[model samples]
Target: MALQRKDQDILNAMSLVESTKGELQKLRDNGWDSLMNKVSSFCEKHNAEMLVMEDVFVDPRKPRRKTNITNLHHYKVNCFYTILDLQLQEFNDRFTEVNTDLLICMASLSPLDSFCEFDKEKLVKLVKFYPDDFSYGETLCFEQHLDIYIDNVRRDERFKNLKSLGDLSCLMVKTQKHLAHPLVYRLLKMVLTLPVATASVERCFSAMKLVKTTTRNRIGDQFLSDCLVCYIEKELLDSVTNEKVIERFQMLNERRVVL
Candidate 1:
């Protein structure tokens, strides 16, 4: 969000606009090569130590007595390349050509760094990218808003140092100035709603340890979901004492049990 995506796009476009994708691909290829080289160096440095298997001195036919039966080869091929391949596939899937362009355009609405990095051209591309979402009049009106928004944001200290799009949305609401930049604020709201990262969702998996286990793995999906909700919000659950919990359980269907 702090990047000048418009300027970067324009700078890339300077060398024949059609070549930008090619250049980006080249950079990706170079990055992949660099990663492979690093992995190769690490493997070479530790090949003997990592790939060596323990000696098994007995034949399979004689393994009925004291013997170490082993089928693993000493020359183990690491699956680091497979991991890199999957990561590349995931990246390509999520960041198709059109999606990359859309994201670059969306960066125009970012409120980080006092809005000094906002670009009208990228904002215009964003409007054009989704014609149905934004009308012609609204996009045209955005030009006026863009200038006023930059001036207003630069002058106002309240708009500075926003950590994320969520912060930006809250600042917009707090200032009560959505009317000043309706299109930008709308885009801001949309960006705020986007699931940029899965850290919050990923945290739930850590919380899952509290409920699901080998001995109690028959939890239904709905029940597991309820458990996760409770697990994730432990601070609130901690506030409810044993008495309150017992009361709630007793209240379920006319006193189900006494805790």
Candidate 2:
């Protein structure tokens, strides 16, 4: 849900990532008893038989073998801990130390809260990662520009109400500050184009799942593509009238009767 925010919340990405990891760890450490209690309550409410944790748990697939593991051991160790470990592993793989550092540096460039997160050193460090984009002299120039840009933007009334990096970029161009501070604007443009906005991409995948369900699994590529476009861009779809849709369908082929 945090990833679904329009603001992107880049400034809090690092903290969010860290806190998520912490929560997962906490769950793995002490969540078993709490989980069991919930399961107990659910089973009781449903009038379902509860398993005795102390009872021997036999492997259903290998009943011939002598199995001595308790139901508690099978559920807690094989299922709960294993699932949490896999989740932690995936999280570690996705958000490496380098990725975390880059996100933190990117957050420093956020224009939200009147550029409260603005940091010259971090921005300079961020540019270093894209050596192809910023040469040594250009990097030094960007570092210098940060000093002037942050000071001017923070004091400028136009920038005070900025809610996002996109807003900041447009305001920079609108106020002709981009011309004076081309490098800073260039960095802002770079930041805007970064794939750090995974929320939108995640949302696209989610929309795809809704558009292409099990019943529609065999749908043609073109039809699925059209469905996804309408599903994902609902705001644009809302503007389209039913008459306009019928007109478009009529235009596509000669029907038995034209409406």
Candidate 3:
């Protein structure tokens, strides 16, 4: 019966935990109780009726006593969760509802490293999901479709006399005058706009590491937070309202002597 098979699957998954009891016990001994609890909770909540063992491999390296390193063994357990067909459909529909033009623009502006790794098939899928929104009118929807857009543009007498980026910009400016939906116009503006890179966040962390080196590792968490906030948000620090400054000074003065 289907019910029996589902029950068997759950049992098989639980058996994997039982087989790893020794490792799990070691983890508990090492103060990983919270992690163990989370894994147990995930299994309980997911209704993972079937668990299948994947690949298992053992390291050929000899154990090192000084480093407390032992032979490594890796194993994986696969589990499945059931979802209703309607739920899946609803999820797919929501993503499909996003405007194609906006999606393409966002995708174009996404980190180069992230977008470069996507395959042609994935790109096609994305385009298909939001076909109506993209400005494939100016350029081909896909590299393969480039000729289509080019032919369309070439045949249009309005664009026949236009050439170069300046001409394209002028056309775009003229077209904006007739936009019916303000939301679409705003979305287009956002997609065309370049996003500022967050290299400063990385720089801030590097500065924090330099400031809190081995010698200062014992620094209190609160003090370290205050120091970093002041250093990183120096501009905002200068703009602190007079009322806040007065309240802070009053609190500090009350804690000690008035100067």
lDDT of 1: 0.64
Q: How much does candidate 3 score in TM-score?
A: 0.25
TM per candidate comes to 0.51, 0.71, 0.25
Separately for all candidates shown, the number of backbone clashes (residues 3 or more apart, or on different chains) is 0, 0, 5
Q: What is the C-alpha lDDT of each candidate?
A: 0.64, 0.85, 0.44
How many clashes (backbone atoms < 3 Å, residues ≥3 apart in a chain or on different chains) does model 1 have?
A: 0
**What are the per-residue Cα lDDT tens digits for candidate 1 across 197-233?**
3345557777887689877788888998888888888
TM-score of 1: 0.51
Off by over 4 Å in 1: 1-87, 202-259
Which stretches of model 3 miss by more than 4 angstroms? 1-197, 241-247
The candidate that achieves the highest TM-score relative to the unseen native structure: 2
lDDT of 2 by residue, 1-259 (tens): 7856765566576678789899999999999999999999999999999999999998889988877789999999999999999999988998888777777787887777888788888888888988998888998778778888889888888888887778888888999999988888888788777655488877888888888899988999999988889888888899999999999989998889997
Candidate 1 residue pairs in backbone clash:
none
State which candidate has the highest lDDT: 2
- For model 3, where is the 10-residue window of minimal lDDT? 73-82
